[model samples]
Target: MRIHHHIGRRTRSGLLAGLLAATSALAMGIAVAQPGTAEAAASLRSLADAKGRDIGFALDPNRLSESPYKQIADAEFNLVVAENAMKWEVTEPNRNQFSFGQGDAVVNYAVGSNKKVYGHTLVWHNQMPGWTSNLSGSDLLAAMKNHIAGVAGHYKGKVFAWDVVNEAFADGGSGGRRDSILQQRIGNSWIEEAFRAARAADPDAKLCINDYSTDGINAKSTAIYNLVKDFKSRGVPIDCVGFQAHLIIGQVPGDMQANLQRFTDLGVDVRVTELDIRMSTPANSSKLATQAADYKKVMNICLAVARCQGVTVWGITDKYSWIPGTFPGEGAALIWDENYAPKPAYQAVAEALGSGTTPTTPAPTTPVPTTPVPTTPAPTTPAPTTPAPNGSCTVTYVPNSWGNGFTAEIRIRNDGPDPVNAWSFGFYFTAGQQVTNAWNATVSQSGTQVLARNASYNGAVAVGGTVSFGFQGTHTGSNPSPTSFTFNGKVCANG
Candidate 1:
């Protein structure tokens, strides 16, 4: 769901002709592109890559058709997240029937460009097919499973991730689960069931629970933190936690990094899913500078955390940003201005990524302790296999179970005298297990064997440093831990 209130009604049909003309103009190099005459600078993607991170942008196909948006998106970003195409209403407008044309087009374009695609959401309160509102009990639960399976399965491996569940917590009232048709009819377990269904259908895409106002350790964020903790302690198939950084100028949360770190510490990946800083119309020099600082703070924090995967701006340019439509009198929320030129904020992000220091925010003089002071929590289960003899690395495999679906964490440690670079960990699951969602590492599977490579930030570990990643998987009958483990192709000595 959108953090800002979108005014009036939204209709894809209404903007078709205008977008078509914009596309034509862009092809002919006759459009009023905003980036004209702006000096070329290092792209955010390149800078992030240097730091072993990913830079991304959320897109509406209509906006992508415009030359300015397309040019910047293609050059500056390597990840594409569908802004509205994958929502429930758009994908399943008429009950049991499904139409994936819009979402498919977005994925197709991303694949053609060699970009990673993140599906916006599978379950959200704001957008739902009319047919769903009338259902109750089994009907509603059935509908939920059907929709998730259909949409997630249609894209299958094409989408790298999905916002499996979005905005499930209320801002007030003890931070309880938000009241929606799904929860109202199917009970609180709907969330866990949604993840389970998604894993069964795709078995590869990363599934995330996304929301706004979670940038800090506040009541809402606390509620989410507890939920994730419970999910991990048990065996819910949650992969990542998404924080929608829909912020105001000069108001970046001081504890944002700490909040993210706590989630990753729970053996899940964290991402800045939808980021935009909106300000009053006619932004002055000071406002722009403040926005730049806020942008840099976010970039630095993400780059600092090994489990912080990527950062995605809500939209590429202020010209098409949802701020103006949703929040009256508030505009200019993105990195690029209306004319497609890089704003001061863009430069700040680039500089932060280029710098090699850990990003830090000024601490509040008086802070509220949302949870315990975080310590390195040992893996829940002991190492399943023995340690490597000649190799100085060890692995601990832990799995939390529920029904036939489970979430697993893999912790890899360097116990040798030297550091390791570009590390890889491989294992075999004897129980016909298949991974559905993974984070903090690049994961792939070949039959019963699974391989996990380090992410851009976590590849290098010091002599005694430990780096870990996790995923959700499904199994039939008895689920047993892998019998053996390998570190960079060397079998461990101790079992």
Candidate 2:
């Protein structure tokens, strides 16, 4: 579901003081930490607080009764968005017959927890009642205005921001307006009318235009960008733009940061709304590690942008994730798993958010040796010694292919006695494949030869250990994998 409205911009600095106090409390061990190593123990909310940005999750009201679900929700997130309770159908199912029970439950929980509420959708194409589609012309416009007024006015000060308009643009090709009932009957002017009504109802809220598949600079995002530009020029009461970054594993766009920068350059805040990266599951360690890296990459991107307000994952845990039902054979989207245990992704997100903050205690200095041992001088005559065997490696390429594009996960295993430090792997694509984006490594291509160097966090490969990275590419005809690979200039066996 999607909604849109025009609300005012919020002052981010105001949140810093309170958040800092909360962060201090957390560091002092007053707050509950997830089960793991010391570094993974910091709550995501506290880490994000130190950076002056909110880390949020969509609340499923039904799950609020569950101990584990509510525990994580209250402890890890600073803001809450109702997954479906605030939508048009749920808010006002039968025209003028408003129901705030479900919506109020979510809002009440957020208020009690001292977390801010983000009202989802005042006007959206999906999840509206059948009666809404029956109306036409002037009647339709009036209904739209009434719905926005009722919903926005009720949650007036409670909601810090609103997704005033959601998914207004078409999906593919040369993106244009979607042919929803509102668009067909009331025309494009309906969007502006909805925003106007929302502004009048709740003048203090920060309003936004939200959409999916526009996390990167693509045709769909460009279309929304044009709309935002036009809205700003005409004094449309929009304050932010929401990128529903519903991503796939290893498919994060290479230009994601640049794309967000362009939107924020237009003088409106940007948010990563509805974030969840899904992969084929029955989860495995390899896929979970990749997911962790992807989540870290996203959080880092948001931190890099000055006007990115915050990030809100669509759901709190994988058990309640919408991916498994919507996209069969795909699950394990959120940082927490089915049993509500923290996964590698939880640590990754915490580390990313904590990157900008100073440690509570200073790191200990390394001790210097007072006396150095004498070293033996080199002999003029060469002394014979047993030679050490060269390191061996194997590369396994697994590709998920489609018509003209594919994503491949490549794993490099070190099969030698000694560890490979600061490793570099090189290979060639023989099927006219061109890599477009990659994760967990720094990959560069010159013709068919591609070189992938380990990232700062994954530079060392221990003996009998493996490191994996993936890339998305386009191919024509046969998409054949490389028959061989080289690790640190030594040819590796193919797997």
Tens digits of lDDT, candidate 1, 49-103: 5455668888777666665456566556668888788999989989878988888
- Per-residue CA lDDT of candidate 2, range 1-495, in tens? 332221111100001112333344344333322211111133465456557787988886878776556656755677899888898999998989999998999999886665779988898888888788778779999998999999999998899899999888887877899888889999989888988899999999998999988888989999989888998999999899998888887988889999999999988999998888889976777787788899999999999999998898887777777777667798888876665555667767878986322211111121110111122222334222322324487777777665675657677888886787678988766655777655445677766677787654456677788776666566776788777678887777776
Q: Can you list the residue pairs that collide in candidate 1? A: 34-339, 34-340, 386-494, 386-495, 387-493, 387-494, 388-492, 388-493, 389-493
Clashing pairs counted in every model: 9, 8
Best by lDDT: 2
TM-score, predicted candidate 2 vs. hidden true structure: 0.65
Given candidate 1, what's the lDDT at residue 187? 91
Lowest summed lDDT across 10 adjacent residues in model 2 is found at 8-17
The C-alpha lDDT values of all candidates are 0.71, 0.73
